[model samples]
Target chain A: MEFSTIIQILDSAVRLSTPLLLACLAGLYSERSGIFDIGLEGKMLAGAFAAGAMSAYAGMPVTEGGLGMTWGMAWMGVLAAVAVSIVLAMIHGFASITLRGNQLISGVAINFFAAGSTVLIGQHWFRSGGQTPPLSGAQRFGPINLPFADAVKDVPFLGPIYEGLISGHNILVYIAIATVPLTSWLLFRTRFGLRLRAVGENPGAVDTAGISVVRQRYAAVLIAGILCGLAGAYLSLGTSAAGFVKDMSAGKGFIALAALIFAKWRPRAALGACLLFGLLEAIGNRYQSIDLGAFVVPVQFMQALPYILTVVILAGFIGKAIPPAAGGEPYVKER
Target chain B: MNKGLPKWADVVLIPLLSLLLAFLVSGLVVMFIGKDPIQAVQVMVSGALGKFGIGYTLYYTTNFIFTGLAVAIAFHARMFNIGGEGQAGIGGVGVAAVLLSVAWPHWTIAIVAASLGAMAFGAAWAAIPAYLQAKRGSHIVITTIMFNWIGSALIVYLLVGPMQAPGMVPETVGFSAGAAIPTLHDIFPAFDKHAPANVSLFLALIAAFAVWVLVWKTRLGYEIRAFGHSEKAAVYAGISPLKIIMVVMLISGGLAGMMAVNTVQGEAERLILDTVQGAGFVGIAVALMGRSHPVGVVLAAFLFGILYQGGGELSFEMGIPREMIVVIQALVIMFVGSLENMVRIPVERLFVRFDKGAA
Candidate 1:
């Protein structure tokens, strides 16, 4: 491949993988904490809508509207989204943990509620059936040009890679990448991590040891909500600056679940899995752009790739990838 | 008053409570939206119940019975086979394909072939998810949801592409005249032209009875029920979960596919002619609301059928958004999710093995 084309591919890959990475990290937090949170997609969509609506209401000031939008304002919007998502995730945790309801059913219910509430609210607020007004380009995330890339433009591989792919990414892309090791550390190397893992594998053991399952799961779900919120923000503030549309998260949350399986529920492994699925999705979308006329792949088939791969990965490989022993079992404390 | 009538009262009571709660909550939402909540509800009710409303409601109920039966059958085997929607799509496709390919002159042969073809296709579709679950120990929930999306896209591609009937509006070709379900109007000279209710309703009723017998009266039923209670125990009894999973999923899928006979053969007369709609998913709510009993399911389906038919009529008469029906449906599912919590009173559990009878 030409050096420029290689650089282009790398750039596209980062952009494509951002949302998946954020979602996987979110899944890691919740599942690791002993809550089987299958409602990540709903959480992310809610966050996206919150961010989009907030931006629209604020009316992009010309100063903050440009691609050079300060890190502060973007972070503020992302933080707000996270806060909103956290509230919703808390509801999920309350239902599953506190009420001892069926986690799967509760999660599905959350998804339906999210889907309906967001659309109804958005339609009323924006006077549209779906979607918010697009953010001004100034308000949208733009590329960052690092120092020395200009000087290294003459270098063969290193120069092209630095100047082309890594330089122009939006802020969220960097955050998504950095989260992998951070999540891994949080999941495997800390006191909290041990407790979290113990709760998932053997909640009764955790409870016997005096650690509260409710507290641990609530924390885990909150972390999940934050990450999901960031993922949502990336879709609106980072990718398109377009408002949230109905069912905008699509099936990405489930794809993240698949990534967890592909990674064998390990945070670091999940990064590779997310990247792989993202690569498939990125390639599938571009297949039509670079067509082999006789070998034309239908868009429907192409779109089905991630889900199909999920099924294959879950059903074919990953032999004996067991979840936490007490994953779906609700803990009831006798007063 | 009939014997065991109090038990039946609970059945009506629970759904009615859910309905009332959904309406009240939604009414508040409508008032917030600056619409007349009372008028909106009035329009919705009259539209569903007035004049020929009963006919359409029964037609809608027919689809629900098949979908609900499909879901309940799988639940009895402890399988969460959520691919009813996908299976329905494929089944509808099979019906459409048969209608297009068949040159049969008799309507009876064509209708039977379409229905059977649909059931077979649905069974095969569900088997894929069941196989993944039994063989690989993969969770069926995620796989089945994926299959629903894939199935939907497949139908969309086929209908708008290769399966497109000539001059049809993004739909399949019209079925042969012989393939149409014999309408009540044809059987009764004085029948209403506006009402097209057919014999599919009777088929739904018979299917419910058959399902009841299958779940409660036979050795296989015992095995199925045993598996549902505890898979490990079922395995200890020498019953293979793999075999049962496959059998139950296929049976469930086949029943769900039968909805096409009601909709395609009975109403639309061709599959590609319309969208798969959400009957299959709604079936889940029906089964849950019915507490997974065949008799209860029929009643629940009819109640929902009325709301669905009436909701549309309300939209026209009272100027409420038609989507209000969807809101209500979602509420019903929500309430079903919380029903166990709502009824913490621990009434008699009928499905559990009877100690006295066993002794």
Candidate 2:
């Protein structure tokens, strides 16, 4: 492949991985806090719908049945995404934490609920076959060019790499990348983070320390909701599509969950894992099939690679991927 | 051994109450969409239970029964086999391969061979995940989910490359006429001739009864339930976790595979992409609502059948998306599976108070 081709693939990879990175961080918070969340897909879907609807409404004129606002309304869309995702997360928390129900089942229910309701409500509102109206300037997160991107573009190999790979992403992409270091700092340096990790590993110990296990878990779930909301918003707003398509998350959430496992629940590793998955996807998208002199590889195989790799990793072929000790179990006070 | 609630209440009442709650929420959603909730229910009832609709309902019920039992059997061993969709899809391939291999003289013989082929293929698909879960401690849920994606990809490859018919369509040629299972209308002339409900419905019922017998009346069943209740206790009692896991998964996968007979051989009579549809996930809701019991699974399967058939009608008549049924199914699973304690605690308290008064 040519250098520019590689750069282009990497560019798309960066764009695609932003959502995975965000959702992976979301899963990192929830799973590290001992709550196994298979519902990340559902939360992201709900968030995407909320963001898409809000942004579209914000972009339209007042006479055309819209909020008639510009630039700042996209932020409101992100907020709406977060709020809706948080509500769904609270439902999962209520079922798993308070009701002490099966975490996996709750996740499954959430997925079905989101998959069904997003389109149901979207169609009811838009009558566009479950899709929000296409967004435009000021309504979507337009790409941002870093300082000297234009000046540096004509310089050399390193210049094209810098401008093409690093600079022009929507605000959410930057936020997603920035979140990794912030997450690492919060998880490792803060007292709250210590208690949060403790609850996932050993809730009884945290409980003995007079830290409320429930409160820690709820907090973790809330953070997961916020991160997932951003990921969803990024999908509908930050991407070139600039509209919510039905089922548009398209298994990205599961891929994010897989990235979380591949990363072993670390923020830095998650970024790397998400990028790797993203590159795989970008390569698949760029070239429908790769040709070698001897034979050809099909696109389906490429599409299935991430899931296949996750299974291989899960099977302990590479290494044992152990979950947090209390993950998937409800904390019972007296049991 | 008696809990706060009576046995009958535990078996039937809780699910009924959950169903009621699910419908109540569904009604609210309908109202939110500026549609009449009562009228929607009326359309659903007539669309699912009316003479023309009942045949389709039964056909859907047949698919759900196989998938529901598949999940329920795995549930007994505390394994969540979420790959029913993949298993059933692969099972369709098996049925297609078997039915296409020979032009049998009799439908009965062909059905038997196709059923075996379907079960074998489904079990084979599930074998890897079961082994990984049993030996390496890989999470079954994650592995099975990955398998669903892998299985779909495999189907696409097969349909496009090797198994493609001599046409533009991404499907196999129709199965031999003898291999085709007779629809319900063939035996009962009163039913709609085009409806897909077929003899596979009987097979599903038989499978359900067999599952009940295997789970409750057999030593293997005892070991599975014992393992599910407490893995350490079962291990101490000499029950092999590996054996229970593998056997239970094989049975589950085989049962899931049987759904192909209804959809592939009986209805479509050709191998097509997405043959299983979302019936596999519906199995999860059914198994949960049924409390992982065979009888309950059948009843829950019928309820989902109504939702599916009715939802299809709602899409045509009421402009409600077919996905509305999925929403209702999700709510039912939420209430019955995850939020049981929400109802159980209050009911238990009431029952305890009543017992105290009687004493």
Candidate 3:
């Protein structure tokens, strides 16, 4: 394979990995706080719709019959998406925390509710066939040309790769990358992280410390909401795809869950898993059929690879995946 | 916060209140969307229960009953089997293979053979996740979900590549007439003349009863409940977790597999793409609403059957998005299954007060 082709693939992989990375990390926080979030997909879908609708309503070109807000105001869309996601996170927290509900059932209900409500609201508000209007200019994220990108262009090997693959992603991609370490530190080195992990592992210990398990879990869920909200914003505003399509998240959210498990719920490991899945996706996108002269691997196989890998990983082909001890169980103070 | 409730209130009153709350919120959402909530309900009732609509409703109800029973059986063992969608898809392949393999002399033999094949295929498919959960400690929920996607991809590959009809169409060839189950219209001429509701409905009812008996009356059922309630105690009592998980999944998968019969043999008479159409997921809601009981599953299935048929009509006639029904169903599941304690707590308190007064 040529270097440029590899660069292109890596570049797309970075782009595609952003949403999955963000969503996976979001799940890590929620699950580590003892709330098994099977509704990441639902939350991401809700985020995507909120971002697209808000951006379109605010910053689609007035020439194209938009709401006439400036490009800078388009970021209000991200804010709106975050708000919507937080509300969902609160509902999840309420159902699973305050009520001590079945977390999986709550998650499943959220998925259904999110999928239905978003489409219904989208059609009701926009009337654009369950899609937001086209976004333009600053409403959509454009590539950020890093300082010295041109200066590094002439350097050998690493130069072209850096310029082509690393230096030119929307800001959200950068945020997603930076999040891995931040999440790692927060999960490992911070006081809140210590309490969070303790709560997930043994909430009784945390509760005895006078820290409310419900409050800690709620905080973790809210963090998840913020990260997932950013993911949704990136999907609509960061990528070249500037509009929300109905059910556009497809299975990405579920794939994120797979990544969370594949990474064994570690933030650093999650980064690798997300990027690996992203690379596989990128390969499928580019190479409909990979040819090595003698034989070709079918696109169907390529498309199915991630799910297959998820199954194999979850089946302990590699290692035992131990979830946080108290995951999916609503923490009961007395019990 | 009270834990105890009268048995009658535990089963009936909680679900009723939850259903009422779900509908109340759904009504608010409908009104918010500029549609009259009352009119929407009226339309839904008329569309789902009208003679013409009842047939379609029952057809959908038949599908849910199989899948709901599938879920309920797994629930009995505390195994969350979320892969009913994929199992049903695989079951469709089994049904198609059997239907295509022979020119049977009679529908009776053909239907029985197909039913057996579907159960086997679904059970086999489910066994993968079950094995992982039992032997590897992999969470059943995540593994089953992955399998759902894999199953869909496999079906797409087969339908597009190998199983495609000789012509350009993307489905398998139609089943032989001998393999086709008789529609309700054929069995009961006195009933609606063109109902797609079929004999599979009867089979679904029988399967529900079978599951109930298996769960409540049999020694196996006792072991399953014991294991689900306390694996440590059950183990001490000599019950094998592996055996229970594997057996429960197989039975659940078999019941889920039976869902394909309604669509493949009873209605479409071919293994078409998306034949299951999220009924597998809907089964989760149905089983929850039914409280994982056979009698409750039947009633819950009928309720969802009505929503589905009526939702379609609602979207068509009143311009209300059919997806609204999904919100309602999810709300019902949330309130009834997850937040059952919300109602149960208050009801228990009330019952305790009544008991104290009587004393």
Cand. 2 Cα-lDDT: 0.91
- What CAPRI grade goes to candidate 1? acceptable
User: Looking at model 1 chain B, which ten-residue stretch has the lowest summed lDDT?
Assistant: B344-353
Off by over 4 Å in 1: A1-3, A60-80, A148-154, A289-295, B1-23, B167-169, B183-197, B313-323, B342-359
lDDT of 3 at B147: 84
| Best model per lDDT | 2
* Worst lDDT 10-window in candidate 1 chain A: A65-74
lDDT, model 3, position A35: 95
TM-scores, each model vs. reference = 0.89, 0.98, 0.97
The per-residue C-alpha lDDT of model 2 at residue A224 equals 95
lDDT of 1 at A273: 88
Could you arrange the candidates by DockQ from highest to lowest? 2, 3, 1
Model 3 residue A326 distance off true place after TM-score fit, in angstroms: 2.1
Please name the candidate that would achieve the greatest DockQ relative to the true structure. 2
> What is candidate 3's lDDT per residue for B169-198, written digit by digit as tens?
779999888887888878777557676798
Model 1 gets an lDDT of 0.77
TM-score ranking from best to worst? 2, 3, 1
Candidate 3, after superposition: displacement of residue A56 in Å?
0.6
